[model samples]
Target: MESLSRAGQEMSLAALKQHDPYITSIADLTGQVALYTFCPKANQWEKTDIEGTLFVYRRSASPYHGFTIVNRLNMHNLVEPVNKDLEFQLHEPFLLYRNASCQYTVSGFMTRMTVTG
Candidate 1:
């Protein structure tokens, strides 16, 4: 009887842990500039140019899985928001240029495992 009770308690703990939120969220990424790197070929990592600013609007998170949907400034791809997983590593944060349009852009963040070599 005691063993069965312990098993139930463990399962409850596991469930609670699964419901935990990922560390990063949309609010944290909004208004920040980000870069995404993808390897067009094996052993080579390619990074996107700093074309615009990043605006994270919606995000889904859990202890082990999560993704963010973000909008970029000046990058009108017709594909509104981009999806980024939490596992991706966002690099250094810096500032961007503001032309006559009076726009403020951040440096940029990068995706995880963009390069293998």
Candidate 2:
């Protein structure tokens, strides 16, 4: 848990460096908890109870190669709030931008292995 907190702090610092309007301060990350569960069957992370803006760092190969934000509000203009699980590949990386409230909880699972001899 301590390591995760430190990592969140570092990510917040890096986001600030980007000077992105969507990115918020480190304080926004306070009181936030991250939970992870591994599901070997799917080989993907099932995320739930996510209440915040999610930012994905796009590589140079991507068209919008920068920090792109994804939030429930902007997700296909849904009439109701999201209540379903969002899945992401374990091999891919995901970054949280900011939580809407301090009480919000972010949960997911991921596993990646690198084989280099």
- RMSD, one per candidate, in order: 16.2, 15.3
lDDT per residue for candidate 1 within 12-73, as digits (tens), equals: 33433343333222222222335444344654444354443232222243222222323344
Model 1, C-alpha of 116: deviation from truth (Å): 32
State the displacement of the C-alpha of residue 13, model 2, in Å, after optimal TM-score superposition.
Answer: 2.1
Off by over 4 Å in 2: 1-4, 20-25, 28-117
For residue 95, model 1's alpha carbon misses the true position, in angstroms, by 15
The lDDT, on a scale of 0 to 1, for candidate 2 is 0.32
lDDT tens string, model 2, 87-113?
223323322222222222223222222
